[model samples]
Target: MMSILGLLELNFSFQLVSFPAVILKRLTFHPDDCFEVRTPNLASLGQEEPWTPNTLSLRLDLSDPSDPNVSISLYFDPGTRPLGLLPGSKILLHNVEHKISKRKNVYCRFINTSVLTVISFPPSLQKRITTDETSFTRLYLRDIRGSVQGMQQAVCSITRISRLTLRWNCIWCGKLFTKGRCAARQEGFCSSDCGRFGASASVVVDDGTAESLALVEAQQVAVMLGLTAAEWKVLKDEVWMRGELEYSYNQQFHDPVADPLWNVVAALCCKASSFRRFNLSFCLKKQLHHQDVSEKTFQLGEMRYATQLLSSPVLFVKNITPSDWKALVSHWQHLHEAEQSTH
Candidate 1:
C-alpha cells in the first residue's frame, strides 16, 4: 500500500497529494527482450511510482536553488506520448490517483488532467551547470560554436548535404581539376578537370544545440571512385548482366532533389529531444569564405572570414582503397615504361 505522508481534498474527482516537485532529467524506452517495456509494479527494484523496469531512471541532476524541492519521477503509459516533454523541462503536476498492485506498492497515476508544461531550456541557467562529463544540463546550439572549442564532445544529427562537397582536386597541383593533365601527376587529371561532379559530397549535421559539417575525409572520395570502377569492370565482363543507364555508384550519390533517400536518412538520424553520443575534438578558427558562399552572401571587406568546420565520423565506413595501393601501382607503371624505353 502507498504510505503517503498525507493527502488533501481537491475540486476534481481525485485528491491532490503534495509530493515533492522535480525537473525531468530523462525519459528513455529500452527494449526488454526486444527492449520491451515492463509493466510498473510494486516488486520493481525500487518501489517508485511512474517508473517501469525498462525506464532505467538514473541521469538526474537536482541541485537547482531556484526551486529547492525534492526530486520526483513521472511515467506516461506506453501509448501516451507527451508532445514536448524533455530533459530539464519543468512540470507542475497535481497528479494523484492511488492504485495498489499485487506487489503491494502504491502506484500514483498521473492522468491527462495533470498540469504539465514543457519549458524551453533556460540559457542563463547554464552557469549553474558544472563541467561534469555526465552532465547534460549545460550546452546549447548557439553556444556550441564557441564552447566546443577545446576537446569537448556533444551529440548532433547529420542534417543537410552540401553541394560544395565532392570536389576532386589534383593531389599534386592542388587546383580544382576541371580538365587537362595535372602538372603534378602524369596519369590522373587535375581534380578540377573533373568539374563540379563527384560521387560523394559534404553534409551539414547538428546535435540539437550545435551544427557542424559532419566530418569528411579523403577516403569518402576513394569509396565513390572504387564503386564506379567496380561497376565499370562488371559491365565490361558480364554478358547477361542488365545494363544500367546511370552508374551503380550514382545510387548512393545524388543532389538533395535528385535523390530523396538522403532526406529520409536525415530524419532517421534525428531523435526528438535525444541525440547520438560521440567522442569528438573541436577547434574554433575563422576561415576565408568559400567561393559559393562568398558570391551568395554580402561581404564588408575583401578579407571576409567565417568559422570553418570539420568533424570525424562515428559511423563506420568501409575501406574501399588502402592508402599505399595507388602509390604502388603508379610506381610499377612508371618503372615498366622506363624499361620499355631502354629496350
Candidate 2:
C-alpha cells in the first residue's frame, strides 16, 4: 500500500485511452448457444494473444435499434465477462480496450473484469445492487461439477490462493506485465512512470466435492489476499530488493513469519466464517484449447470458471481503493497531455 500511496505523491502522469461507451444494442454475438442475443453476425477478431481466440462481436444500437448502419461492431471474449444478458437491452461499457486488426478493422475488446452489464431492470424492481457475493443452493463442488446441468451458479470459499504472479513482479515498481510493458505503461507510458515484469496467478477453489482452477489476474489476487496493490508492490520490492519481511496493509506490519492480510469477505447478506464466499454463476462449456488437446484429441479441465463472478466480491478485498486505480488514471491523463504537447 505504501508503494501506491507513495505513487500518489509523485505527481506522475498516466495516459488514459478511452471514455465509457454507452450504447443500446439487441445484445447479439456469435454461437447463439444460450440465445442471449436476438440477431447475430460472423466476426473476424480475436485471433491473437491478449485477445480471446474465439472472440465474438456485437453491434452498437443507434437510431431506435432498428437502423442497421447506426450500430458499430464491438468484439468480446467469452468467460471473461458476466452472463445472463437478455436481448434488446441498453448498457454502458467501462474499462474497455481498443484494438486494430491486421485488416485495419477497429475492435473494442473486453477481457476479464469487463462487465457485460445488464441494465434492463424495471423502475419498480430496480433496487440498489448488493455488493455481496451470491450464495448457491448447491453446497458441494461435486454436484455442481459432475451434474448434467445447463447453467449453474454457487457460492464457495477460496480454499487455496496462489501467489505466483506477486512473486514474479517488477523489481523496482512491482508491476506485472502482459506483452512487453507493465500496466502503468499499458496505454501511454513515460520512461519515469513505470517498469515491466512478467507474471500470472490462478487460484484453486474447492467446495469439498471438487476443486476448480480459476484463471486470475494480479489485481484480483491483491483484493482476495487482503493487500492494497501498492502494498503488494512494496512488499514484493522489499522482499526481492531489500530482503525484508512481508508487509500487510490492513494490519500495518513488516514481519517475516506472518502473512499480513484479512481472512474474511462479505457485505453481511450471505456471510460465512473463514475464507470469503462468492456467488459463482456459470454453465458447462466445452472449450477448445490448442495445448489441452493431446495427440489430436480434445481435453477437458473439469468444471471451472466457465462460470461468471455474478457481480459480486470473491475474497475479503472488495474493491481497490480510489487511491489505487484513480491515481493511475490521473497519471495517464497527464501523460496523454504531454504526448499531445510533443506532437
Query: Model 1, stretches more than 4 Å misplaced?
Result: 1-142, 145-151, 175-202, 210-215, 219-277, 287-343
Q: Which whole-number lDDT from 0 to 100 does residue 205 have in model 1?
A: 38
Segments of candidate 2 deviating more than 4 angstroms:
1-140, 143-153, 167-193, 196-199, 228-230, 236-274, 280-343
lDDT of 1 by residue, 125-191 (tens): 2322223233334333335432243334333333343432333344455554433433344555433
RMSD of 1: 20.2
> Can you write out model 2's per-residue Cα lDDT over 133-194, one digit (the tens) per residue?
32224333434333335544443445444333333443445554323344455545423334
- For residue 221, give model 2's deviation from the true position in Å: 0.5
Worst 10 residues of 1 by lDDT: 239-248
Error (Å) of candidate 1 at residue 224 is 14
